[model samples]
Target chain A: MNSRSWFRLKQNAPKLSMLAYMVLFFIFLLGPILIVVAISFTETEYVAFPPKGFSLRWYERFFEYDAFVDSFIVSVELAIATAVLGVGLGVPAALAVTRGHVPFANTIMTFLLSPLSMPLIVMGFALLFYLSALGFGVSFLSLLIAHTVISLPYVVRTVAGVYRGISPDFEESAAVLGANRLQIFWNITLPMIKPGIFAGMLFAMLISIDNLPISFFFGSADTNTLPVVMLSYLEHQFDPSIAAASCIQLIVAVIGLFIVERIYGLDAMTPAS
Target chain B: MILKRSGITTVSAGVVSPWWIAFTGLFLVVFFVLPIVNNLLNTTELATLAKQRPISFYYHKLFTDPYYIRIVFDTVALSVGVTVICIIIGYPVAMFLVRHSGKWSGFIIFLLIAPLLTSIIMRTFGWRVLFARRGLVNDFLIWADILEKPFMFLNSASSAVVGLVHVLVPFMVLSIASVLRSIDLQLEESARILGASRVKTFLKVTFPLSLDGIGTGFIIVFLLANGSFVTLLLLGGGDLKTLPLLIYQQFTISRDFQFAAAMSNVLLAIAVGCLYLQLRLIRRKGVKGS
Candidate 1:
């Protein structure tokens, strides 16, 4: 190599190695999921890596299983309800704290977002006994309440983050034009924070659907979520069907993420630092 | 009420109706605050219902019992181990993501986040597939002549740790990258112009500045790892019994809600302590930034 080329190669060496490390890191991050996907196509009764032959039998089995199918429907319904409730409760509170000039806004915001830091298992355990004591028992209502509490933070944080960014001048101008408080919110504020509300709702749904620890406490014949069902299934059986179920859940997640990426951008979805 | 400020007549001042705050606060107080209070109350009620000793009995057993003590030690150790691993492996990637990932930043962020969006159970299932006796890891090891027979990687403490690090490294990376992105590159350039080597500049200036990010990442990973039970339950094979795992058993098998409540309170204390430190760090950072 020429001396100039040699100097260039030395300059690029660290970058190239870092690139190499990044590739390895991606593989580590993604390898297991890929393996799960691969095994979902396995013809074997057991989960095989090379996956003896490419077949969709496990997928068929997943659909054919009543418990899996039922729980999946329950999870979807629960997630939808959670998203709605979380937004309803979270957005207005975020608005109150951010724009209402509430006293101790910082402390109130921290309290609202505190659920994000709490251990899910502890929260689930507490809710289980607490709700039972309140005569709610282990039912879907209790489950929804538990899910809403955990997901409320995402809705509040994202909406508050976005709302804080928006200049209050839009609302001020709207108010000056003789618009009422509701009109100012509806015509001026709501449209601006729609993306934040959308993102937060999606997060709430995603968190509710993917939750395991919380769902574990509330699982019954009627209330078992897909994750709860899948856990029980895995404990008793090790089969490729579980892989199929996992891949299906993964597909749902990807679709949700894809929508967020197309609209809000994934980079912007990072919780406020 | 109309408020006039800075020669402007503002009728509403954009103040949200107090009803919004009231409704949300009521919901939280009933559903969130009460449950925790109820959990605390359960600890006391166990003395009456189960004919057990007072609430102190459970706490005493947790701290005094050798088995419980060992589990507590293991839980903290596991959390510490996971946090250290995440930082060691995650910092470089965070640096690359912040400083070097120009065109690929979007795709890289997607890749980082996609795993997080996926259910923890699904991710753990992926590890299960890989660590199976006849799985890829065993196959690769045997094929590479690293062993004569397939070694069981499943259902062990080491496996649990590996699973956790894989699940949590993204959080660490994201936390550090967010902070790293905020750090001015000119500072590093100035250090270089001052005749400091690249390594010296990073160690002296960049590393010191990034401590807040590391601290944030540390607390987050530690808290998450500390609460994590699904990964342990799925991969731990009943060998590694952390408080969460024990609590899980209490609810599922033993039906000891009282003891479980007590254990979770301990877990809650640790999580709350970590969160307090994290909030303080963030507030301090915010103060410095402003």
Candidate 2:
């Protein structure tokens, strides 16, 4: 090779190697999920990787299975309820912590975000007994309350992070112009932190829907979530239908994240450092 | 007073209504705080009813029982192993994301986060498929002449570690990258100008500076791995018995709520301790940064 080409290759070597490493990293990250998607289409009774042939038999199986269908609906309903409840409780608490002139705001914020740090299985176990004692009895109400608790921190943290960035001067001016507290919040603060609220709500829904350990504790025929059902099913059987169910769950997550990326950006989703 | 004529009672500009705190606080107290408190109470009550002194019963069981002792050791070992593996694998990736990938950063981040958003069960299922008896991993090993027959990769401690590292590396990467991003690039440039090699500059400047992120990542990963059992449950093949898995078994099979609560209290203590360390790290970083 020419001297110029040799010099260029040497200069580019580190970048090329880093690039190669990143490629492998992604493959390691994405390969299993891709394999599941591939397996879901296999024209066989058993799960296969380099899938024998492409077919939608597993998808058909997913639809036909009553437990999968019912649990999916339950998961979706629980997620929506969680988003509403989490946002309702979290947004105001976040506002209070950030804007309410509360004493020991830092301590209060940490306490509010404490659920994110707690082990979910422990929380589930605690709630199972606590709610049952309270007459919730492993029902849907019990599941909703448990889910809302875990998801509340995401809503609070995201909203608080965004609200902290916004200038309070806008609200001050609006108040001076005779806007009432409610009016000021609805008109000025609400529009600005809309992205945070949306991102937080989306996070709440995704977390609620994807949750397994917490949901694992509340599994009745009526209260079972998709993940809980899938786990029990996998414990007994391994079929391509499970792969299809996984892919469906994955699609929901991708769509949820895609919207967050479009609206708020994923980088901001990192837990408060 | 002037706004009273217009029925717009003037309030302090940033002061949210106290009702907000009352409402949120009450909900948290009932659902969040009460459950955990109830768990503690139930543990003590059950201990008493079992004709053993409440606190001492658990203490005795924990200190004397070899099974419980082994579990505690295994949980800590697994968490430490996972955290170390994550750092070794994740640091370079974080460096690449922060320093190397200029325009591809957004896409790279999405790749890092998508798996996290997906259900843990689904991710574990993906690993299941890969580590199945006749799975791709075995097929490839045999095809490459690495083994005469397929080795059992699933339901083992090593697979559990691999599965956990895959799940948690993103957190570590993001943590280290956030700190790495804040670091002044010119320091490295100055190091290079002063005749330091790239390796030497990274070792002396970049790595030391990123220690905060490493600390943050270590606590976060260790905490998550410590509490986690689903990966162990599905992939561990009953060989790996950690505290969380034992709690699951106790609650589900034995219906021993009190014993499960006692075990979970130990898990909770470790988690809360980790959180304390993490928050202290963040506060220190905040103080230094500002």
Candidate 3:
């Protein structure tokens, strides 16, 4: 009886512990996320989690609000534009850092990646002064360029890491087979690193969408991204609408992340992060 | 190997030397260096303004002022408290993930890192909803009859710190876990084999191995916690003020750009110094290890 009872305990212990931890961690982390998701579908005028009298009322109201919709389009446009611009700059830089034997390459790589180091407010303040002086004063392109600058490091780091996975010998062998540089890149390099590029683009899009502090500086009434709009709204009116807007941005970001994970394993992209 | 100069040299046909230099160099000049210099130039009036405003007066106001100085200390103390709590809570979770998680590691990682996919604002909203007086947390506590009256979690210092800790814990865990996993499992096994208890083996072997990760994680948690705005602003509810919020208020509410700039510099100094010191130490240690 003693031996049998001991055996039963041994088999159940670790698995039981894992289940317990999973439940607790899920409650602590995913609990909050689930709450926000539930509230997004609420019928209540104010924010509610374990949402009361469930309906799509808030979603409908969000659509009805012209300013919210306008900011929503701006955010989407900014995210797309940032992805393109950031990727365009970051890919070349990543290629250079990985493939080319540039001088002080380590320093260059670190410099490109330094935005990860600074506090957002300092970056915001500095950008505000710089943009104002340059007469880029809250224009769409100014916001576009600023967002691209911050997002560039993510693309560079991710792309460089992805580039590292491409065998150096593959490039050499392609050259030996009389493939030109362009042909080698097109046929071999591009196809291999497509996952990295996509990952970087996804990261750029989400980060640009979520960013508020820098957007606050460069964003005007017209150029304001969704986060900027939400921040301004929160400052003026502390309401469920701000909460509603926050949920929308998070959902969009999670969707973007989900798609990126589908295309490229999420592991492949986080090097930039 | 033949020294035959093939017309298509490997890297020659790849990236033009000038283009790489020009592109990265130009990009850095415009984006990084230019803004810093511009900010410096624009903030030239700070020193003059400080001189005009009596030195003792500023000191008396800042030092003796409970409203301003108390918040500074409160912010610092709360962030430090949260960092400690994160390390205490997160280290074990991270250790469990690395040592015991095995095949479920990827899924567990997904669970941990997925929160970061959402915006900070959204997460704060969720916290506000959950922690409000009439919210789920209070309701649960009240239903359990832990208190006759609902606990005041919203717009409180404790709530702000808890939110920051929750957000920062992932960074601490991930940073430590990644470093911890690289530590040879055999090292811990050897200690156990030599008659060290599990606790002893961890203290003697595993803990030392993960020290760099712990330190890096601590520095990251501390610096970011110091600079955080959204959590303080959203959850702090005008009762508590952090440095970033003060910088914001100075500019937006007070319209004192000079004071805001000075405040910004003070905050920037903390961030930049922490980052610099951590990187230098890491670099030195990395060199030694290599």
Candidate 4:
């Protein structure tokens, strides 16, 4: 066969294999997501797949139930707190590492990312013991501290990547024009890194809210996040309500991830995925 | 010289040193040292917990016992089983995603990643529903007479592995896809031009180049599958107990914090050590190859 035919052979793959892969992945990833969405609309008595009938029952059940609503509110509050705390701890650290000219900068940065690489279960138990011994006793602040720890890496990495993208000349120019270090940062560096910071916050919030094992230890009945709440519901029985709660969180998570991925570009995220 | 010294002094005094130091200090304290300290605390608890009864018996059973060792082996076997399964299943999908271009590539990429957006709880909930006794999956199979009746999919260990593979296959696909993206398509084309058949060209040129991606993907999926709690906790359906879920159970339901901590510390150490070794080995190999 000529080279053209052989090239045709290579090109033939996309149409066939790509379509097959796309279908398989779509079903694999979104199949369950779609199931949850459908189950939320499910009018059945029990959690049913290819949900028997469509109604607003599950979603209605969620809002009508105060515990679920409280957990939802708690999740939102935790996510917001996590975002704020993470950015607070992360941005300065990111700036220092990226532009800090600190000795062993790379070594330090890797240490920051170590938490992300470590098993989260240990951290959760650690926080539980540490907070309990200190008399925090699974309180809101304790959860926030632990969540903030996990969230910090996202903020640091995102903003650091952003800082790397920007040339230092802009800051230097501001410095040359009579800006002090604080003014230079406020006027120039901060704004330049804002998108990264925003993306980082979004990522951090998702990590905080979606967290399972850690939340299990830190969450109390009143303080429970949605995942923790859902876990309790699941441990009890198979019902559409837990699925409803999951659907709600899943929608929010998708939107949150989309916004972050749009701003930061999933490609920009350390290639860790 | 004075101006330069002032600039340097100002940087060290006001901005640079403090930033790095603060970040390094915070990162070290929060992530690195604290978890290490915490894990050590868990490991130290094993002996202290020996007096606790059945849970304590469970610990001794796990440590000084035979059944516990078998469970540990089973856990590793399941993770490896699914890890290998995922690589087999995911590589073709990733390869195909890289082959498509233009609007198609954009569309395919979205489809591939969109599932990842959904909450794990939601995804697992969906899986549980479908795999339930009379759920859609069983309905289809039963209607088609693929099974005499709805065979148990939700409660079985095989089902648990399948659920995990479903959740984790995306990680593998994306990892391989990223590697494939970096692969020069021209090499495959050149191989074709040199008269290697399509199969031969792929086996010789494309597959070898994609090894790093596969390795990355395998490492990630294996680690995740190993450390996974929810998928096992929910889908394992009381039949399976992996290290993470077992750790959680020991601390919560059993109230054996010390033994839980020991097991968790061991698991964490194993995970981190394996990851570090994998990366170092890969880096060394990469350096040698280059």
Name the regions of candidate 1 deviating beyond 4 angstroms: A1-8, B1-12, B43-51
Winning model by TM-score: 1
Question: Candidate 2 lDDT, tens digit per residue, A103-129?
Answer: 888888888888888899999989987
Q: Name the regions of candidate 3 deviating beyond 4 angstroms.
A: A1-19, A177-183, A235-244, A268-273, B1-3, B6-21, B41-72
lDDT of 2 at A147: 94
TM-score of each: 0.96, 0.95, 0.90, 0.90
- lDDT per residue, candidate 1, B1-290, as tens digits? 34434324444444466557778888999999888877877743444666465667889999999999999999999999999999999999999999999998988988899888777777888898788787778888999999789777888987899899999999899989998998998999999999999999999999999998899889889989999998899987777999999999998998877888899999999999988997899799889989
Instruction: Please write out the lDDT profile of model 4 over residues B130-244, one tens digit for every residue.
Output: 7888778889898999899778888678678878998888788888888888888889889999999989998999999888888877777887787777888788775887778
Task: Please list the C-alpha lDDT of all candidates, in the order they appear.
Answer: 0.87, 0.87, 0.76, 0.76
> Each candidate's chain A: what TM-score?
0.96, 0.97, 0.89, 0.92
In model 2, what are the clashing residue pairs, if there are any? none
lDDT of 4 at A71: 85
Better of 1 and 4 by DockQ: 1
lDDT of 2 by residue, B160-233 (tens): 88889989999999999999999999999999999999999999999999999899889889988998989999
Q: lDDT tens string, model 3, B197-278? A: 9789989999988887788788778877887888888887666787788877776677666556556655777777877877
Number of residue pairs clashing in candidate 3, backbone atoms closer than 3 angstroms, sequence gap of 3 or more or interchain = 0
lDDT of 1: 0.87
Tell me how far the alpha carbon of residue A42 in candidate 3 is from the true structure, in angstroms, after superposition: 2.1
Q: Candidate 4 chain B — worst ten consecutive residues by lDDT sum? A: B41-50
**Could you give the candidate ranking by DockQ, starting with the highest?**
1, 2, 3, 4
The full ranking of all candidates by TM-score, starting with the best, is 1, 2, 3, 4
